[model samples]
Target chain A: MKKVAIFGLPLAFFLLAAVFLMRGLYSNPAERDSTLIGQPLPPFQLVDVMDEAIQYRNDALTGEVNLINVWGTWCQTCAVELPFLTQLKDQGVNVVGLYHELDSDPAFGVKSVDVIRTEITEMLKTLGNPYRFNMLDEGRRYSLDLGVTGAPETFLIDKSGKVRLHHIGDLNQRVWQSKFARLYSELESE
Target chain B: MNFRSFLIILFGIILYSVSHSASSVEEKFSFEDESKRALFIELGNELRCPKCQNQNIADSNAVVAKDITAKVYELVKDGKSKDEIISYMKLRYGDFVHYEPPITPLTLWLWLLPLIFILFGCVFMFLLSKKKQVDISQEQLQKADEWLDTK
Candidate 1:
């Protein structure tokens, strides 16, 4: 009994540690709950990417359920997912683009608005525009406020403007079916 | 070369490399108050970059890290306290933004597990020592005494 107890205790500990370490190996480090989930969209007054004269506020997105996609022309994944997002938009989903500009910093030599507009137009014309309207995230302050780590993230906002979900990577059919579709339907019903 | 001269050369090389790397990325932010500048640097060290998992905001070249470092500079310049800035970041990015994790129910085990392991080890060692002492019988003690006398 004593020998068994002595051997079993350490064996149990080793097994437990092995299981924990093995789980860590498979777990995605980037996967974490967003702090802004269940919170209202952060207040912002930003101009449209196409036309700076047209401004948008937090209330602009509150009237209905919307998918705010954080994307940039530079992001390859964003380009790849553009068609899928456009498909969602065509299927009566309100898809808004949050333009996460990379070269907004003056220190890094900022791009002119005309240049950015041309690039956006060229990209959207080629990839099919998924956005209802693109809000220019100048300096990426609004993106930062939205807890955005990088481009290619998407946030699902309900009718009341509460953030329902924040997905970090590209949104595809598989992701939509598994993560977004059911909850989105539930929100639509609500 | 002699061992001492080799070590000196190695130490000199290490020092030169460190100074060279430190001068490579010189971000100039002039502050009126030296203490605020220090605070800004301190906050940069404490704030973890969200995009790059392991690197601090100061060390990471990720765009998000640059945004965060800029924000930290702005907040520090605005005279926000350390805790206020930390909480502000926590609001946006959750507790993961900060290097020091709060001791919650889930994280409490991180602190408790080491103590538990030490206690168990102590108990196991105590039991083993006690068993060793108990294994010395009367005949063994008599034999030891005789051996000592002869010696």
Candidate 2:
């Protein structure tokens, strides 16, 4: 009995470890949910990229269901996801774009905010604007406030201004159909 | 140690110092208050970079880490207390952003399991060593010899 107790403990520990490892292997690293879910959206006031005179505040997400997408011209995945975002817009999903920092005009090799915004505007024009308006994230302070780690992420804000979901990759039909579509419907009816 | 081994250790020390000095040369935030600057540095060290999971925000060059360090500096300058800044970070980036995770019901076992396992191991080893070196009685030894002879 003593011998059994001695060896069994270690065996059980190894089994538990194996189970955890197997679960880790099967899970998607990107699917890890953000802790900000169920919390209110972080406060920020950023300028609209197209019109510097206009500012989009954090309150814009209140009283409505909206999808806030983080994107940048340099991110290739964001370009691929643009079409899906447009489709979501067509389906009547309110989409707001948050432009991640471009800091300097890459083409001109100078630190001109206007030139950088113009380049982003041109890029969006060439592709298509799914968002109501793309807000410029200067110095990425707004992104930091939102705990955004990188571009090509999206947040779902519900009617009451609470952040419902934070998806950490390019949004697509598969993601929408599998998760966000049902989630949106549930939140919309609330 | 041999001369070659001594030379290798010296070389390693030089390499480490060079890397350490390189990081020190990176631009640091300046503050009007020395204590605020110190607090900013402390906060940076305490916070982990969400993008580069293992690297502290102070040492990481990742964009996210840079942004976090900047925020920490700003908050310190704003006269936010250490606890408030930590809570603010926890709210935005979750428990993973800070080095110290709160002991919640879900995480209580995580915090306690190592100590529990160490206690169990110590007890097991103590019992094992005791059993191995236990003194045998003369009568028991005689009985064992007689039993062996009969076998």
Query: Which candidate number would show the highest DockQ if scored against the true structure?
Result: 1
Best by TM-score: 1
DockQ of 1: 0.73
Across B28-113, the per-residue lDDT of candidate 2 in tens digits comes to 56688889988988898999998877889989987888778878888898999999999898877888889988899988999799
Model 1, residue A56: C-alpha shift (Å) = 1.3
TM values, all candidates:
0.89, 0.79
Residue pairs of candidate 2 with colliding backbone atoms = none
Give the clashing pairs for model 1: none
Query: lDDT of candidate 2?
Result: 0.84
Assign candidate 2 its CAPRI class: medium
Cα lDDT of all candidates, in order? 0.92, 0.84
User: How good is the docking of model 2, as DockQ?
Assistant: 0.53
In candidate 1, what are the lDDT values of residues A1-190, reduced to their tens digit?
A: 9999889988998999999999999998988899989999989999998888999998999879999999998899999999999999899999999999876557555888788789999999999999999999988999889889998999999999999999999999999999999999999999
Instruction: Give the Cα-based TM-score of candidate 2 against the true structure.
Output: 0.79
